[model samples]
Target: MLNRALRLPTRAFVQVRSPRGAFDATLGNLSAAGARLVGIPERTIIVGDWIGIHCVGQNYSAEVRWHFDDTCGLMFEEPLSEYQIMTILGSRVAL
Candidate 1:
């Protein structure tokens, strides 16, 4: 079977907190299972680190899967439901 997860390009500011530190980052895209974070401070988040994200009135924990330059990929510990993805896409008042 094909993958059922959905991914979408997005632009939003979100908070990311890791054991190393907290950063102000831009969310490049989002999905039910993971997200791509952009513009992270160099050396703040490395691969295999656990981080927390505050986005769209919700908080999620994710693991850093990859890192390159100023961007990295995160896989959520608990995947967001489909409803949450859509809500994040449409929400403008959320920061």
Candidate 2:
């Protein structure tokens, strides 16, 4: 899938957490606006579902924009600073 603009598609293992409970999943493709993930819970988070992401020693909160089995899209509620995005991308690329 593609995201806003034209960021190179990158894959990463991300830890997704929910306020209602705990969710651990991997993000396969990511960009500045949204991402596609895998291993989403059976009680799948739907559009607008609030969530938190743990990556590269940083935490970010976002909302679920769309989802399918083992794949979900997220839009960061609070845009990450350039430093933060770089940190996440660097760690994932390094892996």
Candidate 3:
């Protein structure tokens, strides 16, 4: 059974940093536990790789969980609160 909370669809632009370097990606969906990203170059990252993600003035430590083509899934080191997720989304809208 899936145990994760429902993910909220979003189109926020985020910066991603991997061992290779930093790149820009689009946030597809987000939840307290993880996020799905698109526009990442294929083969640039692998499962279990540690990465840093920046979005809406917030920084997060995450681990790559899976990837397919240009999209990848990330699991956050520390889960975000519902309030925090809303705050980030709100900031993006306000900008």
- In candidate 3, stretches whose alpha carbon ends up further than 4 angstroms from where it belongs are 91-95
In candidate 2 the C-alpha lDDT for residue 79 amounts to 64
TM-score of each: 0.87, 0.77, 0.88
Stretches of candidate 1 exceeding 4 Å from the true structure: 1-4, 92-95
Over the stretch 27-91, how does candidate 3's per-residue lDDT look in tens digits? 88989999998999866798899999987778899999998889989999999988878865665
Ten contiguous residues minimizing lDDT sum, candidate 1: 86-95
lDDT of 3: 0.86
Q: Flag clash pairs in model 2.
A: none
- The sequence of per-residue lDDT tens digits that candidate 2 reaches over residues 5-32 is 4443566667788756677777666666
lDDT of each: 0.86, 0.73, 0.86
TM-score: model 2 vs. ground truth: 0.77
For candidate 3, the per-residue lDDT at 50 reads 96
Please tell me which predicted candidate would have the highest TM-score against the true structure.
3
Clashing pairs in 1: none
Q: Please give the distance, in angstroms, between residue 37's alpha carbon in candidate 3 and its true position after superposition.
A: 0.7
